[model samples]
Target: MVTLLTGLCCALAMAPKWALPKILAAQDASTESLGQAPADDPRLAAVRRTMEPFGPIESIRVPGGDTTESLVVGHPGHRAELEVLARELPGATAAITELWGPDWAQSALVVIAATPSEFAALVRVGAEMPTEVAAASVADPFVRGNEPTGQRVVFSPDAGRRLSADGLGTLLRHELTHIAARAETADGAPQWMLEGFAEYAAHRGRGHRFAEIAPTVNAALRTGTLPEDLPPDTAFTGGSAVASYEQAWSASTFVAEKYDEHRLVELYRRLAAQRQDAASEDRVLREVLGIGRADFVADWRGWLSAQAV
Candidate 1:
């Protein structure tokens, strides 16, 4: 979630507009089942054709601590790295379930493309994806109202090489939080709340202080350019994207510090569920937090100042 591709993935969750390419039927099932499935084994090829257009080189079932849930990894190579990720699944899932509850899907599918082009093909975001994005949690293409047919976290091939173990863990947890909350997530939900909440959950109990996690915002505050409001969606895609991310994370942190964590969750649900209209949004603000939008912004600004100092 630390790159520009995050916005594109978030947009996909709100409106699943892309179409997946259709796969052709396998000609012979018995023939495909002949031997140890090679990279291009007809059986693997057939399965890939049916499930994914890019045809991942290989996939394996990773067992989770809970018998009911599992993680599936599709990768072109770097089996070692995939194994490392597999080991981290239980911890990540535990962190998310601890806060969001256990009502989400029983399985997670992770795709690790061998190259950027392959990653783009899997996610289908095309030219809009930035090279810097390490990973994304995308809603299933077949999602219907209130029910996501499936969800997966897709990792750029470079992610395995680019990110350290801790960095990778944080990235996975962040994306997983998105998947857990995707069903309730609204397209029109305030970007700050959307991204901020995810960041907050991702960093929970990681012992990162506010100033350390949000140095950009701290710098901005020290320069006397106090951000008066939540960042617009444009900020997520613009040059100030990193700072925008920090601002959002700080805002969510502020909410949790001043109010209760459950209130933060309620705020997200109410705002995300309401129509994307000013009047309805304002009503939700007053009803849920007992404050108007202006007052909330002022309060957030005050919190930012205090944190920066």
Candidate 2:
């Protein structure tokens, strides 16, 4: 099995249901049916080819997105999951655009697997797909200056079983943000910034209270376990993963609150453009946020401390 993990949508998913504002829920009544993928739909080919063996494939057109197309796909057993993603598509796209702007393809493919084998095929992870991972965003390789191709969000077979409708909705937003920002993200970029930015985007404007969004960090802060530095890449995958995700999210949240959403995005663009050492990172932090690396950490720590109460 493939063991290499991809970027963008890897973390614990636990968020309460958020009532969609009326306008966002306008399409809810429309997803009652799903149709077979037409043989000529090129976009469906990406996942449909691999997913067909699991069962007969069914799909629904997402109501609102970029001029191109967006779809949610799955087999019969995954009808409910497919409908949930289809319903969430427009709102999730709007939320991502509200923050990520209109630079991306905006069009996407969301696939729900019926079994672990199907899940691994969709995500293409060589090793067994990790059970804890609920979804991932991937794209066919593209040049630095152009739009990405073959972009899709694949959900594990167990995602719907493990996550509630609203949970899947939050996860959809989380992964879509990754898809939206993939053009700006580079390999070897700092994991803290990458995951933190995604986390911030995921929970932004959802009316989630701080403690609810970051239970691990809140507990650590109240117990006097303040993070002195940003989480390292390894921290995203093991026993420390959940707390690291919370701390990372807090860092991005602090930047967005203390400065503004634009600068938080600007910081992500500059820092994630390529690999950086401490000195280079310090330079970019100062350039974007008008603070050195140490000061950035201090401010983030202070932000976390304030949220403890």
Best by lDDT: 2
Instruction: Estimate, for each residue in 1-309, the C-alpha lDDT of model 2 and write its tens digit.
Output: 111124435545444334222112223444444344466788777777798788888888764653655888888777777877877788888888889899887767898888878877787666557777888887777745556667788888877777767678777887888889887777778878888888898888877888877887887888998987998877888678878877888889999999999999999899878877789989999999999999889888877888885
lDDT (10s digit) by residue, model 1, range 99-202: 77787864566666666676666565645357667677765443465676546777777666665555556667778887887777766666777788888887
Residue 217 displacement (Å), model 2:
0.9
Displacement of residue 293 (Cα, Å) in model 1 is: 1.4
The TM-scores, one per candidate, come to: 0.79, 0.90
The 0-to-1 C-alpha lDDT of every candidate, in the order given, reads: 0.64, 0.76
Clashing pairs in 1: none
Which residue pairs of candidate 2 clash? 1-126, 1-127, 2-126, 2-127, 3-127
Report the Cα lDDT for candidate 1. 0.64
